[model samples]
Target: MDKKEDKHKVAEEPMEHTLDCMSRLETMSDEEWNEFFSDKNSMSDCSFLLGYKEAKLRKEAIKPNAEKAWQHFHTSYIVPETTRRHMGIWIYPLATIAAILAIVFILKFVHLNSSDIDVSRPFMAFTADHAPQLITITEDGSRPNIIEGRQQRDGILINDKEADFTHASFAKKMIRSIATPRGKSYKIILNDGTMVLLNAESKLIFPTSFVGKQRNVRLIGEAYFKVKHDTAHPFIVQTEKVNTRVLGTEFNLRAYPTSDTHVTLISGSVIVCNRSNNKAIKLCPGQDATLLGNKDFDITTVDTDYYVQWKDGYFYFDDLPLVEVMKELGRWYNVDIEICDNSLLSYRLHFIAERQASIDQVVENLNGFSYLSATRQGQKIIISKKMHLKSD
Candidate 1:
C-alpha cells in the first residue's frame, strides 16, 4: 500500500468500542458518568467518545467535508521519520484524533453563532419543546441561561437544586425572566418567599429582588401564584388586559397572548382591574373573572379545581366548550387542534384525565363521546362531528 493510504487508515476496534461506550453512557446517572470519565486509564477512551458524540449529533446539521477534516489533521501534526517507518502501526489512532479535532471545531463555530445570546439583544426567545430558560437583563444586555444542566448560580434556585442562579448585583434593580416553552412547566420561589408555578408557553418577568413597596411581576402566559402574605407590600400581577392586585392570596392567572385574560381566585381576595377602562372587580374564593376585551369583566362562580388541575398534573374540564377543551389539550401536548366542523366548537365537554397520559389515550377518550370524532395526525389533532342515525 502507498504511504498516503497508510496515513489515512483507521482502527476498527476503537471505533466499535466508541459506539458501545456511548450507548452505556446514555443510561448512566450523573455519579456514574463522572466516575466512568474520572478513571485515568480511560482518558483516551473518554476523549474519543465525546468527540464522536458531538460529531454524530451535528452530522446532518454541519455536513462536514471528509477532505477538509483530513487536511486539518494532516497540517496539525508532523509524523517523525522514525514514526513514518512504522506509520502503519500508529497512523490509525493519529488519523482518528485528527478527525475528532475537526468535529470539535465545527461544534464551536455553531455554538458561537446560534446558541450564545447576543449582547445587544434584550432577551432570548426559546423555541418550543425545550427546557425552561432563566434570563437576566442588566444595563449591559441580556443573557439567557438554561435552567437545566448549568452549574453556575446567579442568585436564584429553581426547585432547590434542579437549577441555580446567583450574581452579586442581582439585588440592585436587576430584571429576571423565566420562560417555559410548550409542553414544559417550571416552579420558582421568589426572594419574598412567594411560590410561582409557571404553565406552558409562559413568561414571567420580575426583579431578582423585590424593591420598593409592591412586589410586581408581569405575566405573558398562565401561572399559579401563592403569594406570601405581607400586608405592607401588596403583590401585583400585571398582564396585557388587566392588573391583579392582592395583599396576600393564592390564585391562577391565565394571560396567554391569544386567549382572553382570566384570573381565577382559589383562596384570598384579589382586585382585577381592566387596563383600558380602569374598571375593577373584587374576586372572592371560587370566583373566576374573565376580561371581555371591552374593559368589562364576566365574573362567575366556578369550580376552583378546574382552574388549578394543570398545576397538579391533571386536565380537569367541567362543562367546557369542545374548542376550549381542545386548546388546553393542544398546549399540554404541543399539538395543533383543528375543528373540522365549526359546529363542534360550541359542544360542551366534561372530561377529567391525567396530564401524564399518552396523547393517544386522551384522544381515544374524546372519541368515546357519541357526538365527537377525534383523530391524531403527526403533531396535529382533527376533531369533527360524529354522525348518528335516528331511530326508525
Candidate 2:
C-alpha cells in the first residue's frame, strides 16, 4: 500500500488500540528509545508514525489515558527479529512508535497544565534587582518619610506599601516622590490613573491628589507615561529643559540631565515647550521632538519601536552609534563603560537583547563581532578595537 493508504489504515484501527500503543510507548525506558532512534533504517518509519499521530490528533480532541505521560510508556514498539519472522504478526519499527509517543505526550502535558497559567500578570521588559524608594516631601524640609511595601484604601501604592493621604494631618501634604537608583526601574499609577514607568536613576515628583485643573508631575531622568484621558484636567510633565502637555496619550520622555530632552510620542498627541523659551511644538504619533538648549524644537519622524521597547523588556538599537549603545547599557547595569579607543565610537550597529540578561552575556555578544572587543573589570566595561593579524 502507498503512504496515503497506510495512514488511512492506521486511522481506521480501533481508537482504544491506538491509545493502548501510546500508553505503552510512554512507559518505555530511555535506553529502548535511544536504540530505536539510533537505527538508521527505521528513520522513514518514525516520520510516517509521527504524521499519523498528528492527523489523528487534529481529527479528535482526545486526552491521553496516562496520568503521568512518561510513566505509561511500554516496550511493545518492536519484537525480536527471529520472533517476528516466525509469527504472523507484522512487526512495527520502534523508531516510528517513539516518534508518535512524543507527540501524544506533549499534547497531554499542555492540556493538563493549561489552567495553571496566570493570565492577569502584566508583562514588563526589565525589573531592577534593587527596589525604588517612595517618599512624602513636607514643606518644612524635614526628613522625608520613606515608604515601602504597604497599601492604603484610596491612596497610592509603592512597592507593596500604600500611603494613606486621606488623613487630615497628611492630606495637606500633597507632594510625593519616587526615586529609582542605578540598575533599578520602578512603576507606579498616579491618583488620576496615569501609569508611569520610571527608568534607572530617575526621580518623579507629583501631588498626592489632583486638586488643581492641571495634573502636573516633575521628572528628572527617563520615563514612559500613559496618561488617562481627562480633557478638563490636562496632564503635564516637567523635565529639565521642556514641559510636555497631553490630554490623553502614551509617550516616552528622556530628560537625563547630561543629555538633551527628548519626547517621543506613541499615541494621541502632545505639545512640547522649551523651558528656556516658551516656544511650543505639537507632535503626532511616531514623531520625536527634541529641545536643543534655548533654541526651537527639532521635530523628526522616527521609528516608535526603537524608543518605547525598553518598557516592554528589550534594548532595541537600530543603526545607533556604538557609544550610545554602551551608554544605555551602563544605566541599567549600574556600571561605567569606558571606550579605550575613540575609533570604535563611530561604528553603528543594529542589535536587540533582552533587558534582563546579565552584563556578562551582553559583553560576550559584543565580543562576537570580529572587529570589536569588550571586557568587564569589576563594575566597569572596557571597549577596544580588535587588532587583526596580517596574513603574508
Candidate 3:
C-alpha cells in the first residue's frame, strides 16, 4: 500500500466510533441482540454473516436415532403401500434426520488440521516478574517474549514450558518500557543479545526473548540499537507509524517529539514498513529513512557519522537547520528553547561540538560564528533573526 491509501483507510471511519461499537457488542443481552439483528446495515455485515452461519448449524441439528431411522426408511422400497405418501408423513422426520447426519459429518470429519482457527482470546495475567511484555513475530521467523507463564499458578515453577519466553506470544508476555526525561540515559539488553541505549524521553517495547520464527520490537522516541546477528533469526523494530526490520545489524531510529521519522542506519541493512498501507522500503549502509508529515516518505543516502554522532559525546550536523540543531540541544541539556522569530527557523548551521560542555559554550560558538546574537531567559534561549551582513 501507498501513503495515499493509508490516509484513505484512516479517513474511512471514525476509529473511536468503531472501538465503541466493538465494546458494546462484546457482551450483549437477548434484547440487545434482537435489536441488532433487526437492523440491516453494511456496517454490521461482517459480524452478521458470522452469527448467521453459526446459527444455521444449530438449527440443522437432529437426533442421532432419528437420523438412523431415516436412513433405513430410504432403503430401496418400491411397494406402493410402503412408499405411500401421506400429509403427516414419516419422510419429513426421516429427511430431517438425514440432513442432521450430513451436517454432523461435515462438521466433524471435514476441515481437520487446517489453518482455520484464527481466533483471539481476550484475557490478562499478573505476575511479579516480566509483567509488561511485547511479543512480536517477524516474517523471517523471530519471536518476542510474552509473559513468564502461559498459565496461572500459585507457586513458581522454572522447568515448566509455560515459564519460557521462547514458547510465548506477544499477547502473552506484554513487554513494555517507561520513558525518562531529558538529561537521562539508560541501557538494556534484550533476550536476543541485542543492546539498546535509550536517550531521554524515549520508551521501547520488546519481548524479553524470541518466541516464533522472527524477532520484533517497538520503540517510542530516540534510541540506539545494536542488533545481534542471527542468520536463522531476523530482528525488527516498530515505531508509532513505521517499522524497521534487520538481520544482525546496528542502527539508530530517532522518532523524536518534534521531528518526523528520521532513521539513520550506521551499518547493516534495514527495512522500514508502513503498516497502515502494508508498504515497506529497505535502506542500506550510510542511508536514512525520512518520513515527512507533509510529503511522501523517502530515503536519502548520507553520511551516517552526522546522524549517529549523538551516540558518542559529540553533536554533529550536516546542512541541518538551526531549529533542528536546537531541538537536540534542548534534549541533551535538559532545557527549553524559545526562538524570537519563526523566520530564523530556516537559518542553517553546520558544526561539531562536544555535549559535555555547558550550554553557554554552545551558545558562544554560534555567536562567534557570525554577528548573530542570542540571550538566555530562564530555561529558554532567545535568538535574533536580524543579522549584520558582511560583504567584500
Q: What lDDT does each candidate get?
A: 0.68, 0.67, 0.57
Badly placed stretches (over 4 Å) of model 1 are: 1-143, 150-152, 159-171, 387-392
User: Candidate 1: worst 10 consecutive residues by lDDT?
Assistant: 118-127
Q: What is candidate 3's lDDT per residue for 1-392, written digit by digit as tens?
A: 99978864654454334334444543767566445434545244433333333444445543235434323422311111112111342222323222223333343443331112211211111001222223222222334333332443222122212122233334344454434446555565666668787775676766655678788887888888888898787887888778788888888898764457778888888888875675778888888888765235688888888867776878898877666677677776656665554334446778789878788888877777563566666555666643533110
- Candidate 2 on 67-172: residue-level lDDT in tens? 3432221111111121111123324443344345454654466455322222222211122334443333232345665545554543433443222333313455
lDDT of 1 by residue, 134-246 (tens): 43222223766555444445655454222233232363677778777676777767778788888877888877778899999889999999999999999999998899999
Model 2 residue 167 distance off true place after TM-score fit, in angstroms: 12
RMSD of 1: 24.7
- Leading candidate by TM-score: 1
Q: Provide the lowest-lDDT 10-residue window in model 2.
A: 77-86
- TM-score winner, 1 or 2: 1
| Predicted structure 2: lDDT | 0.67
TM-score of each: 0.61, 0.61, 0.54
